[model samples]
Target chain A: MKKLIFIFVLLIFSFSYAYQFYGIPYLQQVNDFSLINQDGKKIKFSDFKGKYLLVFFGYTYCPDVCPTSMLRISDVLDELGDYKKYVKVLFISVDPERDTPKALKKFISFYDKTGKYIVGLTGKPEDIKKVAKQFRAFYQKVPVKNKEVGYLVDHSAYIYLVDPKGIIRMIYRPDNDDPKRIAEDIKQIIKMFGTGE
Target chain B: MKKFIIFLLTGFIFLAYGNEIIIKDPWIRAVPPSSKNTALFMTIVNKSDKQDTLISVKTDIAKIVMIHKTVEENGIMKMKHVDSLSIPPHSEVKLKPGGLHIMIMGLKRPIKEGEEVKINLFFKNSGNIEILAPVLRR
Candidate 1:
C-alpha cells in the first residue's frame, strides 16, 4: 500500500509540472501559402521543413504589444545562441496593405540586431487574410479621428510554435510571455520531436 | 541587489530634484514612422511622506499624451486611457509593458533610438517635473 501511494504521489507531481499547450494540436495541417520575404523573394511554408519555426503575426505599425512580443521572441533566440541553428523565426505581416516588403524588412531588423534568424513575410491582402483565418488569428482595422494617428489595427497576439513537420505544437499567450519560459518550452519541444536533440 | 542598485541610481539621478519625487530609468519605446502610438515606461518613486498623484503628461513631439493602463479582458489585452495615476508614500510604481504606461498618440515623427525627448509631468501636490527620457528599444 505504501509503494502504491508513493507512485500515485509521484504521478500527481509530474502531471502538475507538465506544460500545457493552449492551442489545438494534431487537428489540421497549417495551410500552405506563398509569401514574399523581406528581400522580395517568394517563399512557401514548406521551405522551413527541418527546423522549428516560431511564427508570429503582426505589423510594423503596431507600437506596443507587437514589438514587445517580437522582442520577447528575439530575446529567446538570443538566449538560445549557438543552439539557434535548430530554430527559425517567422514574422508574418497581417496588414499587408500598409506593411510593404521593404518596410517589413526594416521593421524586423530593428528588433533582431544580427538580422540572422528572423524572416519577415508579407503578401497580398487576400492571402494574408486567408493565412490568418487558417491560423485562427484575428486582425481588424479601426478608424481613429486624429489625422496623424490615422487608424489602428486590433490583432490577436499569439506566437505559434511549429514543429519540424510544419505542425503547430503549441500556442503562447501574452499572459505567460516570458523569454526564459519560451526558450525552455522550445527546448522541450525539440527534445520531444527528436529532431534537434 | 538589482533593486538596491536601482534605488541608488534613482537617488543619484533625482538628486537635482531634492528627492521630493523621483523617477528612475524613464524610457520611451521607439516606433516606426507609420506607427501612430507608442508607450513610455519608468519607475516612479515617491520619497516624500505623503502620497502624490500624477495629474498629466505632455510632450511636444506628440499631439496627445495620456496615461494608459493595459488590462487583460477575457484573454485579450486591451489598453484603457486613464486620467491620472497615484504613487504612494515611500513606494514605487512601475509603468511597464503589460501594466500601467504613458501613451503617446499623434506622433509628429518616428521615435528613434539614441534620441532624447523631453516630457513635462504634472503632479497634484508635487508640482511639475520635467524629465528627459531617452528613446530605447523596449
Candidate 2:
C-alpha cells in the first residue's frame, strides 16, 4: 500500500511538468563569448555552467525602454520566489564608450540594488559587435543636432533566453513584459528540464 | 416660457466653463510584442486663470500610469517617478520625448504603429480631461 501511494504522487507530478516555457525553437547552438564584469574580472559565458540566462543589449542612455524592462526582469526574478537559484540575467552593454565598468555598476544598481546575482559587462565596440552579430543584433548611432557628445542608439530590443549548456534555447521578448507570466513560463522550463522547480 | 428660459441659461453657463486643459497631441511609442513597457507624451495647455496641477493620469491600456521626469545630471539621463507637475495660469506645458513625459508600465498588450491609446488626465482644479494618444514609430 505504501509503494502504491508513492507511485500515484509521482504520476501526478510528471503530468503537471510536461509543458516547457522556453527552449531553442530552431535548434541553433548558443554562441560563446569572453567578457568582463563591473569589477573588471574576466569571465566567459561558459562559466555559467548550470543555469539559464536572460540576455539584453542596450545602452544606459535609453531613457524609457531599457530601465523599464530591467525593472520587470528583476520583478520576474522576485516572482520566481525560490527558483532564482536556477536562472541568471546577463546585462551586456552595446554602448562600450560610455558604459564603462563604473558606469555599468551604477546603472545596474538602480534596478538590482541588492546585486546578489546580476552581471554587467562593457567592452570595445569591435568585441561588442562580434558578440552582437553572433546573437543577431543590429546597432547604430542616431545623431542629435547641436549635441557635442553622446547620441541616441538604435538597436534590437529582443531579450534572449539561453539554456544551461550555454546553447541557444529560446528567446524571451520584452514585448509583453508580464513578469508573473514570464516567471511562470521560466518555472515551467526548469521543471521540464528535470530541475523540479 | 419662464422654465424654458431658465433651462437655456443653465446650458449656456456650462458651455462657457472652458477652464479645462486641452491635451493637443498624445502618444505611446511602440515596442516589440514581448515588452511590458511603453512611454506616453502629450502637450497640455491650461486655458483658465487659476493655477492647476496634473493630479493623476489614467489609461485603459496600461496597468499603472506614472508621471516621470528625465533629469540630466553630469551629462547622464536618469528616470524617476514624479508626483506632479505644476501648470501656472494660462501656460502651455509640453511633455515630449527626451524630456518630461509619462511612463506607462504593465501594458495590457503590445501596441502597434498607428494605433491610438485613450488617456484620461485628472487635474486638481479642472476635474477630468481626455485625450487620444497615437502610437509613434521610432
Per-candidate interface DockQ score: 0.28, 0.06
TM-score of chain A of each: 0.85, 0.83
Please give, for residues A67-153, the per-residue lDDT of candidate 1 as tens digits.
Answer: 789888888897776668898899999889878888988888877767778999999999889888888888778665566666666
- For candidate 1, the lDDT comes to 0.79
Clashes (N, CA, C under 3 Å) per candidate: 0, 12
Instruction: Report residue A194 deviation for candidate 2 (angstroms).
Output: 3.6
For model 1, what is the alpha-carbon lDDT of residue B114? 82
True contacts kept of each: 0.31, 0.03
Interface RMSD of 2: 12.4
After superposition, the stretches of candidate 1 with alpha carbons farther than 4 Å from their true spots are A1-28, B1-20, B31-37, B46-53, B86-92, B106-115
CAPRI-style class, candidate 1: acceptable
Q: Per-residue CA lDDT of candidate 1, range B1-138, in tens?
A: 999999999887665344478999999987755566788899999987778899999999989787878766554556666879989888999999878999888788877788999999998877899999999866
- Residue A40 shift from truth in candidate 2, angstroms: 1.6
